[model samples]
Each structure stands twice: as C-alpha cells, then as structure tokens.
Target chain A: MPYVTVKMLEGRTEEQKRDLCEKVTKAVSETTGAPEENVVVFIEEMSKNHYAVAGKRFSDQ
Target chain B: MPYVTVKMLEGRTEEQKRDLCEKVTKAVSETTGAPEENVVVFIEEMSKNHYAVAGKRFSDQ
Candidate 1:
C-alpha cells in the first residue's frame, strides 16, 4: 500500500482538497498498480512559521 | 533522497518537536548512511477532525 501525502501552505479550500485527493488517488493507482479504493492520500498543511527552505523558515523570509 | 515525515496528533510543545527532529534526523542518517545535515525531517500535525480510522473520523468517534 502506498500512501501519498501532499504538503503545502494552509490556504486551500475544501473543494480543492477534495479534488486533490481524487486526482492523487487516481494517479497513484495508475502508476503503482494499486486499486483506486486502496490508494490513500493525505493532505498536510503547514504554516509559514513551520515551513522552511534553504535553512530559513518561510516566516523569516 | 530520504525525506522522513512524522505525522501525529497536535499539542506537542516546541521543545518536544525539536527533540523529535534531532532524534529522527540522527536515526535516518545512521540507517541510510546519509549525512545528518543531508537528512530532512518534516513534522505534520493533524487535527482530530481531519484524521480517520476505519472510515470514521477521530472527531466522530
């Protein structure tokens, strides 16, 4: 079982999340040969203060 | 690239998070032979309402 997680900023609407879950499930199923129903997709939202890039937090930038 | 993510229920303090990151980074580095600096660890905190088990959200339980 492959669990796909999408991590991004916390500004997406409910509809966007639903669409993302559906699309990611389909893609993962197609590529990995897993059943669409068995493909689990997790959405993780991070705040600017908790997210960092290039050794600097997004909030700091 | 071995990117490790820890997902759990929220409410941990900053100190706990810092310790977790340090430990996870060291563990991944030792096991994967990746340098400590090269190991990236991401902590994802999920709310009870958003988390589910056996088709029932934790909040619903």
Candidate 2:
C-alpha cells in the first residue's frame, strides 16, 4: 500500500517515465516489503514558472 | 529534506493555493524544526481522468 510519487521538471520521454515507474516500484517494494503489484507510482511534472527556491520563482531567475 | 506535496482535484484558485502553502509551511516547520524558508511545498493537480480509486478512474465513474 505504498504510493510513491516522483516530482520534477517536465520534459522526460515516455520511455524514461516507464522505466522510472518500473524501477521505483521495484525498489519501493523491496525496501518496504510491499508486493510489486501493490506498489503505486505517480509522476508529477512541474513547469518552471510554478517552481521556486529561496523565495524566488524559477521563471524569474 | 522534508519536501511536502499536496495532490488533489484541479479546481482551486490561486489564492487558496497560496494560503495552503503558507499554512503547510508553518505547520511543517513547527513540527519538524525546519526553518520556514527551508520547507518546500509542491502542489499537484490532477484532472478527473487522471485520478483513480479502487482500480477505477474517476472519469469513468
């Protein structure tokens, strides 16, 4: 029942996302003792404008 | 790194998100002893079709 989410900037290819989901599911399942089939992975992509650091938006920098 | 994410249906206004970020940052900073500036919060919005529960997507229901 472990749901893992990977958040990063948008632009990865579909193949890379597929590989990431597979690898992350396997790693999470192995480490947390959850079944591979039960591990859920979510990918979140953020545009530069919506991201920030040190009180400054990425788009401003 | 205590990176916090809020995933939900995509309908909220920008003001609500701003409020959420502020409250979440304060709460996390207070509980985890991390400075407010160091606590990063990410908002993830999903359409109905992208969300699922009990193996059925919300759009299908």
Candidate 3:
C-alpha cells in the first residue's frame, strides 16, 4: 500500500481539498499500481509560523 | 533528499518526540546519504477516530 501525504499551507477550500484527494488517489494508484481504496492520502496543513524555508519562516516573509 | 515521518498515536512526551526526530534524522541520513539538515522529519498526530484498521477505528476499540 502506498500512503501519500500532501503538506502545505492551511488555506484551501473544502472543494479544493476534495478534488485534491480524488485526483491524488487516482494518480498514486495509477503510478504505483495500488488499488484506489488501498492508497491512503493524508492532507496535513501547517501554519505559516510553523513552516520555514532557509531558516526563515513563511510568516516572517 | 530524504524525508522521514513517524505517524503514530498522539501521546508521546516532548522529550520522546525530540529523541525521535533526532534518531530518525540520523537513520535516514545514514541510509539515504542525505545531510542531517536536509532530512526533514515531520511528526503527524492522528486521532483515534481518524485512524482505522479492518473497518474498526481505534476509538471504538
């Protein structure tokens, strides 16, 4: 089973998230040959302060 | 780049999580040859209701 996770900022619409889950599940299943149901996708949302790049947080930018 | 994630219950202490991040980073770096700093470790906490096995959720058990 291939478990996919998409981590990004916490500002997506519910419909966008629903579409993402469906499309991501399909893509993962197609590429990894895992069944659609067996492929679990978790969406993790992080706050800007908790996320950083190059030692500077997104909230600071 | 190598990214390590430890997905489990949400009851570990801060000390335990700190140790986990350090050890996991080392392990991933050694095995994947990625720098320790580049080896990002994200700790994901899942609720019992959100996780299930064999159609039975942990909260129900």
Go through the candidates in order and give each one's C-alpha lDDT. Answer: 0.75, 0.79, 0.74
lDDT score at residue B5, model 2, on the 0-100 scale: 72
Clash count for each candidate, listed in order shown: 0, 0, 0
Candidate 3: docking tier: incorrect
True lDDT of residue B2, candidate 1: 62
lDDT of 1 by residue, A1-20 (tens): 78888888899999999999
What's the candidate order when arranged by decreasing DockQ? 2, 1, 3
| TM-score values for chain B across all models | 0.88, 0.89, 0.90
| TM-scores of the models, in the order given | 0.53, 0.57, 0.54
Q: Which candidate is the best by DockQ?
A: 2
Model-by-model DockQ, in order: 0.12, 0.20, 0.09
Candidate that scores best on TM-score: 2
User: What fraction of the reference interface contacts is present in each model, in order?
Assistant: 0.00, 0.09, 0.00
- Model 3, A1-61: lDDT tens digits are 6888899889999999999999999999898888998988899897654443322345555
Better of 2 and 3 by lDDT: 2
Candidate No. with top lDDT: 2
